[model samples]
Target: MAAASLNVENVTGLLQDCLSKLGFEVYPLKVGWYNSVLSPSLRLPFPDDSLAVVVLSTPAMFEQAFLPFMEQRGCQGLSDPIDQCVKHCATSAVSQCFPGQNVDVRYDYELLPSRKPKFLAQTAAHVSGAAFYYQQSDVTDQPWAEKKMFGVCVHPRFGGWFAIRALLVFEDVVVGSEVVQPVPPDCVPTREGRIQLLESFNFHWQDWSYRNIICPVQTYSQKQRDYFSARPAERFALLRTWGFLPKEDHQPDISSDAQSEMITHG
Candidate 1:
């Protein structure tokens, strides 16, 4: 496709048409919006006005895309099953939508030689107006003091039940001044509400109460929650018992750092 043919609307529309029914959401943002939030060293190596799209998975993805993917293509080697499913869906959509385009695709689980993520998932989601990323700084009066509290993204509709999956950069597609950045909705706007959110996320994440801060319209199904709650090794065992993963597949369990780097809320 010609560069002139690609704009934020068509690019995201193509991705949405492909991924939305499979339970994914696509949001478009300029490279500058993402780069402007981070320091120089963390900036993406793209023209400021380059078109980029962020992909997110909602609760329906488990039933809509993942199970079907597993049924058709089962588990392959030791990689995370969810990661494999997401890559399959995202890459296929990109290739099918724009056959010859130069797209710089980055996944949430990928890391640079510097051990940094290819792109900050939450930041991308926030800038793309997919979800509101609430960090410790977003809270006032400093409740944690010396202790550090990690940040989390809350989708207006899905709350924390969604995950930012991938970022697609259209290298040759640049948008003019007409495109404007949209601010992510501030769901947990109150100081007390923000406090509860951070505490639930940092200290009691296992309970998943943080995800309910905004009273999401939908949440993960019981089966989906069960899958995410298990440890990575345990997840493999569960899949095998369910006749999805083959028994002979001895993909070694991922490390703690990788666990922390998962594309999931796990």
Candidate 2:
């Protein structure tokens, strides 16, 4: 049994479907902001010292930023231009993953310049993509700090909303007699199947320290399509404050059965 933690959005159902079909019990992480910060030593997210096979995915931004760039550059892709930008945004996150070690600078193309393009391409693709997936970095400063505080300000002309991909798979799992039920087989109920599992997980910025943030999976399932259809008011509000152009379609979709109600923001 393997487990990997990542910040993705709405993947529990997909995980439940795949793991259950394979006959592996898949219990997801239960989150409570205060739980970790209030008691760092408490094994609140998962079982203590649990060792399992881990499979982690990365954010789409990481994917978009790194993948195509690697393909264009030679085998030693990291030495290429994109790594410079990735490192700029990824400094804090990379440090969290590799604390004592220096940044792994050996781009394959650079190291094996004599290698053929096809062979080098495969190697660089694997390494660069793998680094994005597993290399944990803390975005506690600089650009991340700004984005987190002001939300993701992509473009002045077309600022977008920030959607969070929550991270699961923690160090703790079982809590007393409460064995969190594994994701059921029939429960793989989303459009993206097991692959969608990764897509469902992402980190949304919540300023509410007043209450512990929790992933509302049931709501996600009930309103899956609606959630992704268009931007929410809150998102637009943030963008407006950031001085971005207003959304073209300000009207909410009245047709959606989910008919998204206004959420109370603290």
lDDT of each: 0.88, 0.26
lDDT score, candidate 2: 0.26
The TM-scores of all predictions, comma-separated, are 0.96, 0.18
Candidate 1 Cα misplacement greater than 4 A, ranges: 256-266
lDDT of 1 by residue, 26-60 (tens): 99999999999999888899999999999999999
Report model 1's TM-score to 2 decimal places. 0.96
Q: How many clashes in each candidate?
A: 0, 28
lDDT (10s digit) by residue, model 2, range 1-266: 22233222223344434333321222233333113323454323334422111112122332343333334432232122323423333333334433443322222123233342211211111121211111112222222222322111111111111111112233322222352323212222232331222222223323221111222221222122232333343333333343332445253333323221211100
Best by lDDT: 1
